[model samples]
Structure formats: C-alpha cells, structure tokens
Target: MVLAAASHALSYFQAVVIGLLQGVTELFPISSLGHSVVIPKLLGWDSLAKAQSQSESFYLAFLVALHVGTAIALLVYFRKEWYGIIGGFFTSIAKRRIETPDERLAWLLVVATIPAGITGLLLEHELRTVFAKPLAAAVFLMVNGLMLLAGDRYRRRAEVRELVRTHASTESETEVGRRLDTLDFKESVAVGVAQIGALFAGISRSGITMIAGLARGLDHEDAARFSFLLATPIIFGAGLIKLPDLFGHLGNGVRGQSLVGAIAAAVAAYVAVRFLMSFFETRTLWPFGIYCLAFGGLCTLLFI
Candidate 1:
C-alpha cells in the first residue's frame, strides 16, 4: 500500500528533501506533512497554475512517502519503550501482573491514541481534501501556531493554579518544583481528546497532543515523551488503513520521488527525533509555534 508505494517511489535527492521535511516538521510544532503540502503548493508555479482550473494529485504519493518514513523513524526512536510495552502486556496477561510502570504507561498510550484514531476514521477523507490545496494547508499552519500559543498560555495558567496550591501547603518561601508526572489520568485523556481536532485542522499532532499533556500538568519532557509514544500507534494505524489505495492511483513520478523522499525523511526524521526531545528539555514551544505563524501568514499574504 502506502508503504510499498513510498518504498517504490523513493529517489536519492528527493528522499533527503522530503525526509528532512518529515523529520523536522514532525518534531517541531509546525506540521511536517502540513509543510510538505503547503511549500509545494504556494511555491510551485506550474502546480499552482494547474489548480486554477482544478486541483492536481501530484503530492498524494509524496504525502504517503513522508508518512511511511515518519512511521519508520518513530518505530526506531521508541523501540525500547515498545519492547517494554509488548513484554509488559504479555506478562500482565499470563501472570495477571501489572506491577511495572511500563505496563501502565503502555495502557495509557493505548487510551491516548483512541481519540485520534476514532477522529481520523470519521474525518480522514475530509482531512485529505484539506491537503489537496497548499494554500489551505498554509492557512491551517497559521492556525496551528495559534494552537501552540494558546497551549502555552493555558499551561502557564494551570501552573499558576498549582503554585497557589503549593504555596497554601508549604511553609517555606522557596521549594523545589513538582514534576509533570504528578498530574492525573484525567489530564492525559483531556489531551487525547484535544488531539481529535487535529483531524480536520492542519494542526500538528505533536503540538496539540503535547499541549493537552501540558494542560494536565506534565512537564515538557514528560509531555513530549508521551506525545511521541502516543503518536506512533495512531499514525501507524492510519498508514495501515491506507495501504490498499496507495497502489491504485500510483502517481507519474512516484517511484523515484518516493525513494529520495523516504531516505530524506528517515535521516531527517531521525535527527528531528533526537533534536526535539533535547530541545523540549529546556526551551519553550513559543518559538516553533511562532514560526508556524510566520510561515502560515507568509503563505496567505503571498498567495491570497
């Protein structure tokens, strides 16, 4: 399906380009696939011209390549976690043991992935339409920027409330801060539900979901860890569902483009995964979100 098409279509240079996009955008608050759609749409003179009369389908296969590449990146980055999860699931089943934190976290990821899974099932076609037009994706990228800003704002507000609670209990003027893990499952579910919106809007899956985690009081690192882990199952599931049709409409240059794009995506996505986790430890998401805004706004001004 999509994986096969993506595998078949890849070329050397295109792989690097699309892989870079997939890797970078996937980690940053800006959507990688969103950029994959928008960049070509707005900057592609010939393609844009063709769309004046009707949309072309040139990028669909590219999109599939990026997704497959991303899926591979995710699997590789999180392999250790997956091993623990798989082992824990089987151990729990055979021995009726749920002692390990990994088992519980594994269950949590399952719960978290459900909202997006259901949402995608219901709205996938409509969501695909959004990517068919580059300008629209650019506009949505702007909206994603707002989402990040709003997420940071809300998270800070929640922190304030937590501080008040902390102060009421503590007698000392200065104390170490509580980590994000102190938050409850309710917060995780809230974040999971928020992820559903990403179905229609060009919202970053990581951005919205991470915001949801932050809203529930998870620290940036923990929130991000959970975000990447939660994302895999859903994205992988979507790829599986689309596997069939990837062959039917095979684009003109799919084979070569896919090869280049996939390699790029793999290398880039690998770097992005490594880079972003480190970045989340110290930096705020404001910068990434604002970047999305600038790009989105630029696309709008230039095109419309």
Candidate 2:
C-alpha cells in the first residue's frame, strides 16, 4: 500500500523555492538539509512539516532527489575533472601503481569518502531521529557559523606564518599551495574524517571539508575546488541509494512537482558552483559565516 498520503500536495511554487534554496545552500557552505527542514516550519506549511515528521522516508527521499539534481549539476560543470579521475582510476589498475597526480588524487578522494560512508551507514537513522528537528537543526546552524569563522581565522594565521617563513628564507625559496593532488594520504584521511561531522543536519559537507582543506594548507580557491570535487560522488551516491524509496513515495500528483523541483535544483546548483568558483578566488568565508550566524539566530529565535 501507499505508505501514507501527504495531507496536501506540494505546490509548484513551493517546490521551486525549496529546490532553489537547497541547490544554492548545498554548495555555499550553508546547510541545505537545515534549510529544507526549517524553511517548511518557518513558512507555516504545517501539513507538510507534520508529514515529514511522521514519515522520515518521505522527506529523506525528497532530499535525495534534490541532492541528485545538485550532483548532476556538479557532474556537468566538472566534467573535465571527472574525466581525468575516471581515466586515472582505470590506468592505476592497469599499471598496478598510482603513478599520475590525477590517480593519486582520485585515490585520495576515495580515502576521504570512506569515513562518511561508514558513519552514515552506522549512525544516519539514529541521528536523524534527534537532530533532524527544526529547532535542533537551527541550533546546529549557528554552530556551523562558529566553525567557519574558526577555520578562516586558522587558515589566515597559517598563511601569515608561511609568508613570514618565506620572507626569512632565500629569495629563490619556493612555496607550494596544497593542491588536491599534493595532499598526503594522512591529510586526505583527516579531511575524510572531518566529513563525518557533516552527517548532522546543519553541518555542511562543503563547509566542513573545505575547512579541513584550509587547515591542511590549501588556498581558498583550491580548497573550494577539492571540496566540490569530493562532494560529487558522495551526493550522487547518496541520491542513488535513496532513489528507489523516493519513487515509492511518488504518484501522478506528486511526481510532477518532484521533477519541477529537481530541475530548479539543477539550475540553481549550476549557478552556485559557477559563482562560488570565482568568489573564493578573491574572497574569504567571513561573509558566509556572518550570514549563517544571522540567519541561524533568526531561525532559532522563531523556532525556539
């Protein structure tokens, strides 16, 4: 039987708004999951929120669809990188060695993804029962702001120290930016471990991973690149895992809205990635940090 009917249909406008919100926030170091949970409550969509609270599978499957849309956007935008990684994956198997930088980077992403996969498999259901609530997610969103600020400040200090050391050394001394391919296995593992934190509703996958990258000495732009690249497989894989359940919840009435939402999510994600690739080159995460603090605080006040 159909598990349970939603009390009301999700309107097209609401679908679009939620899709845009999810897509943009997914890449922007804000928590997409947090927004999805909180926005419905804030908008007074009582039936939807009640349904979500009642049927975790329904809401989770909807989120999975949104994530799949974002993943598709990432795949299209980063097609070149994906090509290299795929080639490297096969070449390493043939050669019996991870020879190329691309191959090593590919392996590194695999290593980094392990913790999240394991953590999710073990803890996802349990955590969702507690942390997926609007009030709890809102509280964690503010905590996310603090994490961003701390990461940015740490990176700045590290950079300054590096600059001073460079100045003290010979004029011909070389400096290396921590490019994705250059990350040591241990460092990659550290980043992967950090990704476990993102399983919580308000902790952003990109935000935490990039924080770990910055902590490991990557420049802002490169950190963002690695973060986005690392995100593709996880998001896509999660969506794929949840897809069957998502379809189960769909009917003639709800399926169209879901498709519309997915398309809107794809468009928004593409724009977000394009804008952020440029923005991080010259900008810092401080603005995002501030925004999270303000927005999270407002949500907390309203919800609590």
Candidates' TM-scores?
A: 0.81, 0.90
Q: List model 1 lDDT by residue over 153-262, tens digit each.
A: 77678564584356322122322223443444566677788877666435788998888776665556667778888877777777666554345564444656665776
Candidate 1 has a TM-score of: 0.81
81 in model 2: Cα distance from truth in Å?
A: 0.4
Q: Give the Å shift of residue 227 in candidate 1.
A: 0.8
Q: What is candidate 2's lDDT per residue for 1-304, written digit by digit as tens?
A: 3433531447778778888988999999988877777888889876555444443545556667788999999999999998999899889989999989889978988899898888887887777777877888888899999999999898767564474344322121223344557677898899999988888888888999999987777767878888999999989988888788677744324566677888999999999999999888777789888888888899999987
Highest lDDT against the true fold, candidate: 2
Worst-scoring 10-residue span by lDDT in model 2: 167-176
